[model samples]
Target: MQPDQVSIATQGLLKGRRVLVTGGARGLGLEFARHAGRAGAAVVIADILANELHAAAEDLRAEGIQAQSVVFDQSSPESITDCVVQAAQWLGGLDGLVNNAAITNSGGKALNELDIDVWDKVMAVNVRGTWLMSRACWPALKASGRGSIVNLASDTSLWGAQNLLAYVASKGAVIAMSRSMAREMGVDNITVNAVAPGLTLVEATEYVPKHRHELYEGQRAIQRQQVPDDVSGVVTFLLSDLSRFVTGQVMAVNGGFVMH
Candidate 1:
């Protein structure tokens, strides 16, 4: 279904905003783009997946939303710089960013069993990539006068999920980095915050074991598997003026699974 074909009851919270989401061609990133578009923002979806990226953007355009897609490697500085510039050009301006691209399940092994190559690759993409994207978008964000950033973190970073040491560490770093970035960006009137979602059932997590799913579901006070929409709404709010005073915080959208 097209975007307009769906309910648009966001009250135009993000109207007149231009937002970009990394890894936005699939999974949770795509959901963020969907919500942003419905909230009345012109959105740009960037990802390394060429075909899916184009299709995702077309999906938005079919709904009469101003949307575009770009393919670039989050791990490559040159690619990130060029992509941000291209995204700003596509939207005619930039107001918000969703750093939702990151590597997880890098071997899915214990820290002692993890390969150095896998660890490095995860850090490069998950940690270093977020840094690069944020830096590249700094100028455009400042220009918006109502700049906002929502970094994707994980509940594992807060409550320690086993066998995913690298992902947990990377997200922990994201949480830390967001606090520092908020302190700095507040001078530019840009709010920087991280959304640490629990075990959300997105397309990327379709391979998750049934028992593992049950475990997460059972742990949640809501007693159900979390979905992308569960987190997307919070991200949309952060990107909108409704959350202007909220920054440097890690809002967990885990259905009370890992309350902090």
Candidate 2:
């Protein structure tokens, strides 16, 4: 049973596409890379965690998928530029970019008691990193002529959450930036969109207090928590030709947690 023999609805949806997924070493990013690779896309798993990225790539390759790993630091503008260049060179040009790298910390205090340093770090990684990555990949995306960009946003961006002001604010910026990018790139045939996940149980959310976790659980009409697989499908759709007519939209995969 070879990978090419696997039967799937979106089989070979990206047969000749080259995809670069930032922060793809683990968790949701890893899931995205796996799905895209399985769908016959040549995936470049870029992450700051070099060891893990290499391992993930190897695992994919073992499954007969065209996958590679590159060391990348999304938070640094220079690093992001270098990464995009290397990735484009390695993949022979990019068709899709996943801006999924972000930093999140539990700011236990309210606005008055918040640490300025933590706030800066959060914004730097989430907002600034996303912007830099998108800009660096702009030329390659334009060249692809059917390019797509998906930014990982959070449900908090749509609605405010207490004590997590920095994360919320950064995601809000992601949504806005994505919309603007979509408009700017539409003429180039590059679609930009955002995926907002509501309280997904990923490594990034481990620090969230139990009460806060419960809050999300209670809000979900489905009465179930979200998993990485829950969000990966929508991401794949947005990156595939199925979404060619879709742009500047924020797709939520929160299991009925957030209607918006």
Candidate 3:
């Protein structure tokens, strides 16, 4: 489906919820923001891509969704804190946080050949960034009295995909961290969950080899390329009041690629 035609079945499911999505300039992040906004939540999309971020928020506004944009660098701690402040201020408070910013700089490189700097960068953004963003958003989310954190993981980590050690390891950390965070934050009525998507067809995965893409497609039960919407709905559900009792869980939305 075209971008404008992407329909969210649960309209007003997130009514009165304020959401902040990281790396929301394009691809899956953008789609998650769109779905949340369509579900009746005001959204703030933060990204390092200034131009695309603003343009995306404008597009959402044009569609009559309450949306805003903030520019932030996921690798920088100060930036992550500032982004949360800006987003929370804009939305009055944060009800949901989507930790979607991540890097695959170590992609296509074997563990032995991967540069230390590349591995560190991936960890800094994918692992540390998620932690800090969630930390910074904690107060606002807790104040909302019903907060949900959705951390973006990858199925590559579950199946131990080769030649992508840094990213895989980082997402695995995210999965573990989400569970820990959930256990600690459940007292505050906050839910922390991880969503692991497969080899999705998004801008971020454009560099994935054709053979790898075919491998994902041929091995999946759905037998087709996965789109952003396939995962966005679950994310929206998690962010909404519907999942108030759910916490500390990992939902793999990979078309049955990793059935666990």
Candidate 4:
């Protein structure tokens, strides 16, 4: 099954693969699911938003793509566990995981004005949630014999954004954890990597100010706004045979906003 919007040559790029994407009902996650499906992977998108999740899945199905959506709560261990198990069952097995689910809160809140509850909530969803999802999918991933994991970080963490200390700190932890995750998962032929994307205009990012978009565009060498599609292809590559030998790397998809 494939989507009519975009076509891909399905010559084992992602053939016979099964992948699970968290926070995938819309925005970046939705794009990933669509692109991956086109590439020949059986894609499952999990998100906390039930109505949106079902709608996204139906859209894919309408395009002849076999897609599934599960209700996911990143901060809940039981939710993560059950979601992974069900996704694996639905797909027959697991081959890849995209930890794309994260909460950015309101972008501009300085530490002095930031609430403790907000900070803790950000950490719980971004940092701890990724770890929990990876752990829960470990066995099924190991069984794939060539499993891939993609954790979504952000450019804010890479080049430090003002008024987002908690989020930046959490993603920094994601970068730090990627190395260890790769080290451990390598033993099972599962590659672990993190992707840091610039501000992209998606449903989840509707709260971003217009000035911020202009600032990002002005700062980037590409001189354009980053879209959800810009970030999906790289992720599909990371989850394909192409990146079999690649791991422990953080690819910044910010159009040169944060170059390492």
Candidate 5:
């Protein structure tokens, strides 16, 4: 959708809604929060980075946006539950959740070279974290009657990156979990979906090998790397009434890098 069309559709569409975004301190998560706030939703930014999360929240508040921040470690089950409860209380209720917290093992290590500890850590945050957050927010979301959950996935899972086995597997799990949750929650009027983003220029992806990035560049039909805003718009749409009929789908935001 074009920017103008999105603006028209979401003009105050989320007015009075409350949203929670995990890992929302920076990068794409920040972008998602900004857009949702601009659309008139009260946003709760949660992240493991206390300082960064607070700074982001202050910045949003500076813009006169209704925002709050909470420190949350996605890899820890206890932290996930606590964060969800805190956010729900802060926001007075919950209407949506963006499971954007994730970590890629340092360097694109193949499965054989990947350390077991790193593998477990990745799964704990990326896969298990998503499940825990969603489950924890189930009751609050059900209360909203118009609940939506957007899980952050990746193009690596779709095309199978050569050396990011652990990250790829986790993202693949996110897609599957999202589908199942969508099916299970559909009867309750809750919508669950995943956003599989292509390689985007962010602090996290800066460490990716140049050659690997070039490979992604070549695959993108648009011939350009993705930006945070590119992915944020779709997330906002999915959380809005515009996509009320959409669920259990993986919306790829990779500039056509992984078309399906």
Candidate 6:
């Protein structure tokens, strides 16, 4: 959905907030940034894809959102640290963080069949990257005094989806980490939570098998295709003041695919 089409209910929800979204060049990450911007937040979108990242920021700017882009590689701890420093500098301290950058190199491969290097890469980016980025942004988030962190997890982890062991395990770790991080950061007024989305239709998910999509559609309570819009609103709420009392929780925005 376009930034101009943001729902009236969420307008001004994040007024005066500053947020940084990882992997904001495209897909769900881009949608999260758009929603945050529409809610009146100053946003910095970080990604490894420099060209697409800049283009997305320009698009957000055209819609009158305060938006900027930074390039960073999630697999590198140095890059993650630098990205947070640059983002926080641009935003004058961050009120919210969306850890949405992750890789699924082990997709379609069983644990036994997955290459060690691919599995390592997935864990490095999805698990370690999330940890490092959150740590790097901790001080800035805490300084905001009403900080919020939303880690983008996957429903696959909850249900134990096969053939994607590395990705599933990585996201599972994120959910667990969010809980512990919440407890530690709570004293500082920083809310940490995880959002688990199931099989959304986006550019990154185009490689998902048709059978898997059908399975999700058949099993979901909503009985329809999942879209980025469906999940982005929940992330925005977590970032906004409305959820100040909500933290250390895992919300599954999967149309009842997994109610737990």
* Highest-lDDT candidate: 6
Stretches of candidate 1 off by over 4 Å are 2-7
How high is the lDDT of residue 69 in model 6?
A: 97
RMSD to truth, every model: 1.6, 2.4, 1.4, 1.9, 2.4, 1.1
Ten-residue stretch with the least lDDT total in model 3? 1-10
What is candidate 5's lDDT per residue for 181-223, written digit by digit as tens? Answer: 9999998899999999998988878888898889888878998
- Model 3, residue 130: displacement in angstroms? 0.4
Q: List the residue pairs that clash in candidate 4.
A: none
Q: Which stretches of candidate 2 lie over 4 Å from their true place?
A: 1-7
| TM-score-sorted candidate list, best first | 6, 3, 1, 4, 5, 2
Residues 1-260 of candidate 2: C-alpha lDDT, one tens digit per residue: 24322226557787898999999998889888888887879989889998988998998888888988889787788999889988999999999999998877736668777788988988899999999999999999999999999999998877787778888899999999999999998999999999999888888778778988888888888777778877877888899999999999998777777788
lDDT of 6 by residue, 1-260 (tens): 45444446699999999999999999999999999998999999999999999999999999889999999999999999999999998999999999999988788887889999998999999999999999999999989999999999999999999999999999999999999999999999999999999999998999998999999999999999999989989999999899999999999999999997
lDDT string, candidate 3, 1-260, tens digits: 23433354768889999999999999999999999988899999999999999999999899889999999999999999999999998999999999999989888889899999998899999999999999999999899999999999999889999999999999999999999999988988899999999999999999998999999999999899999989999999899888898899899998988997
- Candidate 5 — what's its lDDT? 0.89
lDDT of 1 at 227: 83
Question: How well does candidate 6 score on lDDT at residue 78?
Answer: 95
Per-model TM-score, in order, reads 0.96, 0.94, 0.97, 0.96, 0.95, 0.98
lDDT per residue (tens digit) for residues 114-193 in model 4: 98888899899999999999999999999999999999998888898898899899999999998899999999999999
**Clashing pairs for predicted structure model 3, backbone only:** none
Each model's backbone clash number: 0, 0, 0, 0, 0, 0
TM match of model 6 to true structure: 0.98
Residue runs of model 5 more than 4 Å from their true location after superposition: 1-9
Poorest stretch of ten by lDDT in candidate 5: 1-10
Rank candidates by lDDT, best first. Answer: 6, 3, 1, 4, 5, 2
**What lDDT does each candidate get?**
0.90, 0.87, 0.92, 0.90, 0.89, 0.94
